[model samples]
Target: PRLLKAIEQRMEQAQLRYEISGQPARVFSEFLYSTLKTWSRPRRVIAKAEHIGKANPRFVVTSLPQFDVDWKDDVTVLDAKHLYEKVYCARGEMENRIKEQQLDLFADRTSTHWLKSNQLRLWLASMGYVLLNEVRRIGLKGTKLAGAYCGTIREKLLKIGARISISASRSRYRPRIRGRSCSVWSGSGSEFLKHRPISLTPLI
Candidate 1:
C-alpha cells in the first residue's frame, strides 16, 4: 500500500516510457533517495511503474552511485531508468531461469533424509535444465518451439506415446499417433529423434 501510494503520486506527474516488457507494457522509472533510522546515510531507490489495463508498480534499492562515468565511447553512464530496466530486468530473467529449473526439472524435490543426496538431486536437475536449454538453443532453433519453455518442450516433445521393439541386433521405435498428428511426428519428430540422444549406444 505504501509502495502503491508512492507510485500513484509519481504517476500523477508526467513520466516517460523508457522500457517495454515481454508483455509490451511500457515502464516508467524514477530514482528516489531515502534514509531510514537504521541506515547511516541516504540510499538510492528505483521505482518502476507500469500501466497496462491497470497499475503495476515495482521498486528496487541499490548502493550503486549515480555518476556520468562512461565505460566506452559507445557506452554511456546508466541513468535511473536504464539501470532499472537493464540491471533489474536482467536479474528478473535470472529468476525466471531459476523458476524453470525448479519447476520443470524438479530441482526443489529435496525430500531425501541425507542432505548430500538432496544436494545431488538438485545438482542433477540443474544440469538437466542446462543441457535441455542448450538443446533448445541449438536444435530447436527456427522451429515452432524455439521460444517455448522447458515444461512445454518436455510435455510436447519428450512425453509422447511410442512403441519400442528391441532385438539382439538393433532397436526400433514407432510413435503412437491419433490421427493427422502422425504427420507432425513424421517430419520434425523424426528429425528431432535423429539428432537427440535416444539410446546410450556408443558411436564408433
Candidate 2:
C-alpha cells in the first residue's frame, strides 16, 4: 500500500499515467506470515504441527526475491530485496548512524523502554531502507529503466527519467519517473517523499 500510494501521488504530481497489476497485499501478507512462523514458541509450533501433521522449520530472513514474477514488455519490475539491501548497505555505516539518530529521537525520553522498542525499531527500518536503496541503485546502474525490470530479447532498454516536483499545498516534494513516455510511473518517492532514491537509470 505504501509503495502503491507513492506511485499514485507521483503520477498526480508529475502528470503521468500509470497502473499496477497483481495482488501485492496478499503476497506481502503471506510473506509476513511466513516470517512470523519463525517466532512461534515450541508449544505453539507443536499445536500447528498437530493441526497440519507436518511443517518446515521457519527462517527469519527477508523473502523479497520470492516476489519476482514475469510481466509484459511495457511493465517494469521492482525487486523489493534489491531496494532493501541497497539502502542498508549504502553507507556501510548504517548501524552507527541508526544509533546516532535514535539517540536524538529519544533524547527526552526518561525510560529505556521506548529506546528498546519504538526508537530502536524506527532506526532498524532506516537500516533496511539503506540496504534497499543500495540494491536498486547498483542493480539498475547503467541499465535502461525497462531493462531493470523487463526481460527483452532485443537487449534494448527503455528510456527513463526522474524529475522532482513541488506540492505547494502539502509542502512536500516527490520524484517522478516514467519508463518510456507511454510506460507507467515508478519510484520510492511515490508514497513517501522522504524516501528518496539513492540512484536511478534507464535500464538498458
Best by lDDT: 1
TM-score of 2: 0.18
Give me the runs in candidate 2 sitting further than 4 Å from their true place. Answer: 1-113, 143-204
What are the lDDT figures for the candidates, one per model?
0.71, 0.35
What TM-score would you give candidate 1 relative to the actual structure?
0.64
Where does candidate 1 stray beyond 4 Å? 1-27, 33-42, 67-76, 166-171, 177-204
| Candidate 1 Cα lDDT to native | 0.71
> All candidates' TM-scores?
0.64, 0.18
The residue-by-residue lDDT of candidate 2 on 7-91, one tens digit each, is 3433332222111322111111112332236645321110000011122121223423433455654533334333333533455
Clashes of each: 0, 27
Candidate 1's error at 193, in angstroms? Answer: 11
